[model samples]
Target: MKKIIFSSYLKLKSAPLAFMFALLFVAASCDTQDDVQPDSRALVSDNITAALKNNNWSAPGNSSAKERKPTFNTLLVALAKTGLTSTVAKEELTLFAPSDEAFAALGLYPNNIGNVPNLEQILLYHAVQGELYASDLSAGFVPTLNGAAVEVTLNGGVQVNGADVILADKRALNGVIHVIDEVLMPPTLNLVELALSFNPEFTILVAAVQKANLVNTLANDGPFTVFAPTNDAFVALLNELGFPNLDAVPDETLRDILLYHVVPGRIYSSDLSTGDVTAANEDTFYVNTSNLTITDANGREANLVPSLLNVQATNGVVHVIDRVILPELGN
Candidate 1:
């Protein structure tokens, strides 16, 4: 099982950035590992039963759930838990509703929303101060309700923060809703915090980083580009290597593998070119821009899934890959 401490790794500090972007990043870097601060912003409920009771719950009056046909059941539940449902339902705002799969890709299960320290900030980040239709959106940063600016890319099928806008312009009496394929995370968290905050899906990776003692290197003074793999990817690697779990792998071997995923600068998906780039381990991987895939020395290829690209953390960026690329481990 994943450790609870891992989830709280990033909740150790707080800042009043209303949006918790760069401000949060500065605060986080100053925080010590032992100084875990309390976050008053988190919804004080862990499950629907607790949320319904604590949140002054009221059902949506207009059956927008039926008309929107509950297209965002997960999002609605999250709004309700944060007690922002009524505000969203009655106010004039634009909401970017993340699909269930979007949340999953980010390692956030719907049930765990309440446990997150920055729930309010995260939910607010998805909303704009006023209504914005697809036509109104331009390719640039737009202010969100959380007080941060999110990049809107009109180049390829309409992407917000590198996430494709799967469904657009779903009219709500209160506002317009755009369904996104990936969750948009604020730039408050560093790569380590981002991975540690979202667990189970990233437990293996997080554990590896911790075990390798690469946390401080990633957390401080870096705009490193990291190619993170999902827990499934790690599992497949363990099975292939004949290891039951990460612990069975040698520390040196694990550290090298972890380093292999990192590049020493901030390289966003948009900036990727077709060719070979050196990993932190000094190994090379072939990047094919045509399909956005990376091929390792062993000829194993991992596709950079569209739903998990260009996740910007405060100190660096994280790109999710479908497989763990192994370096040439010499005997």
Candidate 2:
């Protein structure tokens, strides 16, 4: 009887050991399965949010978008009007949102907002396609989805157009947002359109553009940096040539003159050098002169004093110069 009891005890102890071994095998299998699974990392959009939250966007006064009331309102309205509410809600977007005060200061949204044709364009000018934080913006031009490029001038802080990004990095669920004081406008003018805006002296230049049938081409996808001449500059050139206007000059002569001011690339004010640089027409031009002067085709030295420098458009940069350059005439 005692021997039977001992055998039963041994069997019970053996059963417990077997159950322990089975449990150990199951845990080992689970660990191996875990190893076979994919490793998960945060997405780029997620990274953007994490960075902003860490910077205390949710905190007070630390963020500009929070401090200012009108600017925030303008941004919200623009987002809705541009059909970007869903986009902003879904994906991360870094908005260089202008303040309502900025709009009021610029007289953009006067009493009548209904008559603005360029409202959509004005909104698009503020947005970039991807999520860019303050750290991501460098001293280069970034292309916007609006088919234009905004110059990212990261000096002390990021300046998009002439507006300083007062609030640097604010994060949203879809993208990042930077609060800018000024509303950025797209310079949709070609060489002629630009000339018409400021320089009445370029009336002859306008006629020449019409004559060459190159208005559409210049208006097209150019990042063409035009060293536009001012009215006084053209008047001075005309005075030197003893001509009242470009109508006195031949059509071909005027065409060559207009083409001389244009360079193929979008050269911003930051890119200019104080030496001889070549134009797209293969003629060498000098920026070494005091007022950024260039010699035209007529050998008539024209001062390239830009009435408006760094006029950024989607296709190119337009620098309104004071004098027309007649490169072909060699005058």
Candidate 3:
């Protein structure tokens, strides 16, 4: 638990070099766009000033910070509290700046920053070392300063850890900034606790797990891979089983079904191939890479939805499946 105590942000005085560079930047723009460095190094050296500007550093559009001062305030205050303001202001970094609405969506208020446990970890999770412009990113795991990795998917557009990159390639003098619409949460909870964090979607699944008394087993200490089913998926299961709800299923039967959805090790979406992986139920599950599908023991197949894939947890990984996996009773 890293406690972040707030302090006043010591302003760095502007240097002649910064003004000289800003003038040079305008002059360079008259030539060709390719001639200029495609990052924040082209802007004023005073990052604190650059971040507060209305227009983005390099991006040719309105800036997120300009639109939502409060969100920027939240982020900047966190950096100042952690004493990382100078590091971001002077060093090379790539920050995924979340929008004001993003923090609101996560139920994070301006006052919540100091009270949140591992507050520094959450802020550091958004930053990566070196200058990474939007064009420099590729679809894979990006290691962050928080010592955990965030997955970047480039199928439709840029997405980091399921958060859509609303605005990309905003340059800052000290680093680069990309505006994201969702907060990239760090893996602070175990599988069970993490699942509970997303209420309503996994409400039925949570209830079933609790009823089975498998909370400890799932949350104990695991590098487990889980194929979690959403609420709709559980409803489908109840209908198929002729039950009114999850509670109507026998405890042993419910436990077996839930166990069937879990794999005993960390398996990410990128690691999938056409092969057989054993589930926690000791039953074989088939993985098909060509179509990105997972097949259960009962011959039921669940396609891995891109939007719901590769959710990281402190103890392991979780992927949301469209359907609930049921094990063959005899097997």
Clashes of each: 0, 27, 0
Which candidate tops TM-score? 2
**C-alpha TM-score for every candidate:** 0.48, 0.62, 0.52
Q: Candidate 1's error at 296, in angstroms?
A: 0.4
- TM-score: which is higher, 1 or 3? 3
The candidate scoring highest on lDDT is: 3
Candidate 3: list runs displaced more than 4 Å. 1-74, 83-93, 98-118, 129-132, 139-190, 193-213, 229-260, 264-271, 278-284, 290-292, 297-317, 321-331
| lDDT per residue (tens digit) for residues 1-331 in model 1 | 1244334435644534454576445455555433433211232222322222232222223453433322355666788789987777667788887866677666667687667777887888888977798999887667677655578988767898898887676555456667787878777887888898768789889989999999899988677989999999999999988998899999999999999999987787767899999999899999998998999989999989788777777677788998999999865
How large is the C-alpha RMSD of every model relative to the true structure?
A: 21.0, 11.4, 12.9
Which 10-residue window in model 3 sums to the lowest lDDT?
A: 1-10
Give the clashing residue pairs of candidate 1, or none: none
Ranking 1 against 3 by lDDT, winner:
3
Clashes of 3: 0
The digit string of per-residue lDDT tens for model 2 on 199-317 reads: 56566556667876668867774668877665566677788788877678676766666777778877776667787677766777767545666655455565554556777655677
